[model samples]
Target chain A: SQTIHQWPATLVQPVGSPLSLECTVEGTSNPNLYWYRQAAGRGLQLLFYSVGIGQISSEVPQNLSASRPQDRQFILSSKKLLLSDSGFYLCAWSVPWQPQHFGDGTRLSIL
Target chain B: GIQVEQSPPDLILQEGANSTLRCNFSDSVNNLQWFHQNPWGQLINLFYIPSGTKQNGRLSATTVATERYSLLYISSSQTTDSGVYFCAPLVSGSRLTFGEGTQLTVNP
Candidate 1:
């Protein structure tokens, strides 16, 4: 079975501080990776997606950027965090023509 | 981009009760999935019903692709089932668009 791992399950950072959330997939190679955010009372919003190593597509323009340095690793980062950056972040991986499997998610709070 | 809409934004039921949740999509999709987000904010994929009907234990799902709508049925509801149910449909690519979700609260 394949599993997705997201680090720093919860985070609290001061505004203007840097942020880095990591996600990796085990037991799957060359899987498509995605980053999504769920704000209070809102639906899941796609932030970024990667098809392969060093390839990324941004869905929403914001202070966030995603990178896929390796085949199974996807990272979300910000040079400086904003108060509105607080939300539940989810990482997911999927094979072609299949349902996505998600990580446990990271609850980030910006102070 | 496809638009996904979920009905009964909120649902309240008693234990052992039965309920149905609906999802409608504005355009044709290549895949449709159902997910359950527990109170603790953990999302578990429940079904990947693209066309036919499939069941798992007390939960079942049916998708009529031609009509661009899907239905999820939950029987003998339990407190553990209280949470938000989301419907996500993929449109012609790897990305999936999600509906706001159906918040279900089951009472004992």
Candidate 2:
């Protein structure tokens, strides 16, 4: 079975602080990876998605960026965080045009 | 970009009740998935029904791909079933677009 793991389950950072969240998938290769953000009481918003290594697509440009350094490793980063960046971040992986499997998610608070 | 909409923005039910949630999409979708976002904010994939029907214990889902709509049926609802139900549609790629979600509150 395939599984996704995301860390720093919960993060608290001051505004302007750097942010780095990592997501790794095990038991699957060449899977499609995605990063989504759900603001408090809001629906999930697609941030970035990658089909292969070094390929990333941004849905809504903002303070964050994504990198798929390895086939099973994806990273979400930001040079500086903003208060508006606080939200629940989720990482997911799936096959071509298939249902997605999500990680537990990281609760980020930008104070 | 495709538009996805979920009906009954908010629903409250007593334990053991049955409920049906609906999702409608603006265009043809290659994939349709139902997810339950728990109170702790963990998204649990419920069903991956793009067409036809699928059931998992107390939950069942049906998607009419041609009609651009899907239905999720929850039987014998429990407190644990109280959460936000989201319907996501995948269009050209595997990247899914999610609906606003149906908030379900199952009271004891």
Question: In TM-score terms, which candidate is top?
Answer: 1
lDDT per residue as tens, model 1, A1-111:
899999899999999999999999999889999999999975999999999999999999999999999999999999999999999999999999889999999999999
Off by over 4 Å in 1: none
Q: What would the per-residue lDDT of candidate 1 be over residues B1-108, giving only the tens digit for each residue?
A: 788899999999999999999999999888898999998889999999889999999999999999999999999999999999999998866898999999999999
By lDDT, the best candidate is 1
Instruction: Write out fnat for all predictions, comma-separated.
Output: 0.61, 0.85
DockQ of each: 0.77, 0.82
- Per-prediction count of colliding residue pairs? 0, 0
Window of ten residues with lowest summed lDDT in model 2 chain A: A92-101
Q: Which candidate's DockQ is highest?
A: 2
- Candidate 2 lDDT over B1-108, as tens digits, reads 788989999999999999999999999988888999999888999998879999999999999999999999999999999999999988877878899999999999
**lDDT over C-alpha atoms for residue A4 of model 1:** 96
TM-score of each: 0.98, 0.97
